[model samples]
Target: MSKKIISVIVALIFILNSIPVFAWTPAESLTSSSVVLMDTVRGQVLFEKNAYKHLSPSVMCKLMTALVTIEKTDLNAKVTISKNAASFNGLNLVVGNQYTVEDLLYAVMLSQGNDAAVALAEYVGDGDIKKFVRYMNTEAKELSLKDTYFVNPTGLYEKAQYTSANDIALLIKAAISNNTFNVIFGARGFGWLNGNNSSILTNQNTLFWSYKGVDGGKLGTNTNPQSFSAVTTASQNDKRLIAVVFNTSKESAFSETAKLFDYGFSKFYTGVLVPKNISQRSIEVDNVKLDLSSKIDVYYTYPVGDSFIKNISFIPNEKLKLPVNTETIAGVLKYTLNDNTVIEVNLYSDKTVSAPEDYRTKIKEIVTENRDLVTIVGILGIIEIILIIKNLIKFMLRAKKTRTQQ
Candidate 1:
């Protein structure tokens, strides 16, 4: 090759290599049987594995029971124990225990009592488990848990009761968003006040102590699935991540959950993947190169040490027209979190660009606005000019007549 050609090619290669590159770290294997990690605010799914397969979620179902009961009854409202509820296979709240909704909620959640969960359901539905079951399904649908189906609140091994890790994560998101629900689930311990003041059942979520900045959560187990599910909210340096893991070993779920939380907080960060100052490449509009004017920004609070890749994809909307309206979406910003879950942002015109106007059109607009005043002024000026011309002609004739008389 000629020396000139070789030099030009070398320069181009150097320029291309100088451009910056960024990416989020890929995930490592976690100990849980199934996991679903996500950013709650941005709706960004950071990690997952076998999240949709239906499996048993043991006492973890109490979250739903507690939530549904709270939805139908006030905390202080009294609910009498039903014969059917008291017979469920677990720690039975004695048949004669007259308790308020609040007391049962504490006992059911802290002790993982089957009877307490059933009693609340029966009290809410007037001794009808079938109607209460319907309520559970309806609530699940409302929360968009299409993969979850419920036949009972206690999450006992029933023929039809089942949920997946994904559905459980969705349920946790819904529960934590509610102010009252978040407060109740995270509560460490509350008094039963049923005569024995010394009787206390603490929460089962151990991460609250072993894990730092750990928020409210729950744990569940059963023979068929050996399922364990937990919702944890942890923050580092003011950044936060909401993590969910389901169907893990009873001994390892806490450690697995903690490791997942650690990975999230330690590897990634929350900021605009596409920095605010950077401009998108230009696009052709009506044979003219119009500067692409749309911008994208992503924000979520996360742990400092999590791995993340800043992927920005450009998409075109064929339906969009040239000189785009500021309000119209011309494209989308597809953000792929390192975990492979994706989200999209609509790209719109950065500024208003309307159809152009001509000089004549602008003048016409001005004339129309001042039409009455302009017309009257113009008529008066014409009359004044005509009168001056007539007076000048008369003076000229008078001067000629005076010269002839002299």
Candidate 2:
């Protein structure tokens, strides 16, 4: 209707569109060929680029080796190094020397030792390296690493021995669940000994020295194909994240990992989405009301927007007996997050649910809980009973008189 008004509206629209809109994404700044940033607790991926693409894991396979060795053998068991294990160029072990599984695992973790990986593999496999590799593959499959395969325990530059960024992230995520693995991975170095053959193994992953909240890390470098990868895990303010990067410089591998971590830390927040012992409902148990509550806290990570929604479904016990205390699980609250993640919090009774009492006992307790009302009702009931008896006696006397007259 007016050309000037339409012109003003057009200018406003253009100005609105011109304003720069920014979203937190890792691709522009991160240079690794493949990368994945994931929330460790939720297993939720924050960012990924070519994460499924097959890339050389290099010495990073030691992460899997350490995990397998721990599962199959005792850490205190002594492992004798063989010629095959000593053949690896890095961290050469004495051919006949014996080292504890724990000390050698330190070599694998901190030194990124091919020799140490092979030794552990041979020891766990009963002198069969391929047998140990099979175990690695089995673990990879079990972890749902669709793009990973292990041909060598040492992570030598074999064309067939390749793993994706996502696989490494997930692999280490599972590996860290074991306390032994977590402890060993976090160590910077150790004075390991094979009898008098003492040597110091220093961790190659720099995150321990550089980053705060850094707990675990694994580093890998390959000269045969010239590739570098790092797996870093850190926790801060109740949030733990895992970052995996491949095909970058040895320096950038750690730096890029830190970048991803900082991004996650700044952009996301994690806390209890559903609090522990929160009352969900109240139900009658044998004429007594009991509050049903969640057993534990359900934590989740999200950005600025509260994007995920929770749906709780209560599954009460089929035969929940009365007189149950707070220890007894009344049921379970199955909280479904976006049709993918399900957190089952066991529901418990807030207080004891007692069995129904006998009438006398019930009255006594009622009187105890409320004396004034109980007294008033008790006196009235006794009076009513006496009045009925008195009326019955008068009627009986009248009947007796009539019979005597007859």
Candidate 3:
């Protein structure tokens, strides 16, 4: 081939190679069997795919185990490892070895140590493994997770132990809220020495290396069921999100979670549903005026270009009685999207209203104090005068009739 022709061919190849071989679509691109992306600040789901499907959570259950341990036992407390705990696969925790709860927590969170999980559970459960699992179930119930159950502290492949992607996201949200859990979950690596034995823990969450704004995460895998799962959290541009993926390959877990976080941060954001220092207004009850309290600093997450701010309606409680006390709930501020209620916040009275009475002196004083009260007082005064004149005329007519009968 001629030199010019060869150059042209090479250029064509370069252009074709630069073109995308596949289009990216979140719903179709993900490889996980189940996935969920949530706005942690607003507790709203940004994306989901079979999110409720039951699957073996594998080691992701350690998050709950860590949470229970953090709550039940002090971090500085010393825990003696038992034979059962030491027998846990993966970590080489020696039987009768002693380690601080805090050190073991790092292992459980960052290193994915099954032995550490059992040790923490034993300490928190008072040496009863079954009781520790019960505590995990109790927490799941308290979180209102309908599809989660725990048969062990370590997320081993138990036939009866299973959780959904949605439930795992919820669990992570609850776990990361704690300062201790958050710190350990985000650590890239932690190291310590226990009686001449050097122990080091390192995070397996690849998103920390591959993505930005990754705060914390957990990974789980099981060969018996051939399952892989991951839960991750990230914050960007004032928005925080949690993502979970299950039944995926180890590599796909990180990539899929990154895609979910990208979708969430790019497509959703927190918006003010009600602005702070909203103008205070008044409601009239039984001819008495009660001032409504202002709503301040309320927000919710929504699609990037869509907003519920304009759709919010402040509806005062119609049944509020006169003489409403200050700070009493008098109404609700309803936030609606597509005509469906999304949030309802209670409205309270800013100031109390006294009982309504036709005291002329009080009315005169109110009218003098507020120009707006004049019209109301004037109409009431006219009505009172008309009723008084009608009574007087009836009395005169009755007296005249009595005189005529005499």
Provide C-alpha RMSD values for all models, in order.
12.6, 10.4, 10.7
**Candidate 2 off by > 4 Å:** 1-24, 141-146, 159-161, 192-199, 222-225, 282-290, 305-307, 310-331, 352-406
Instruction: Compute the lDDT of residue 361 as modeled in candidate 2.
Output: 86
Worst 10 residues of 2 by lDDT: 301-310
Candidate 1 at 375: error in angstroms?
A: 16
Candidate 2 on 287-324: residue-level lDDT in tens?
A: 67789887777777776566565676878876787778
lDDT of 1 by residue, 16-60 (tens): 999876533324556676777665666556567777877785644
Q: Which stretches of candidate 3 lie over 4 Å from their true place?
A: 1-24, 279-282, 290-295, 308-319, 336-341, 355-406
TM-score of model 2 vs. true structure: 0.73
TM-score-wise, the better of 1 and 3 is 3
User: Can you list the residue pairs that collide in candidate 2?
Assistant: none
lDDT of 1: 0.71
Pairs of residues clashing in candidate 3: none
TM-score of candidate 3 to 2 decimals: 0.77
Question: How many residue-pair clashes does candidate 2 contain?
Answer: 0
The candidate that wins on lDDT is 2
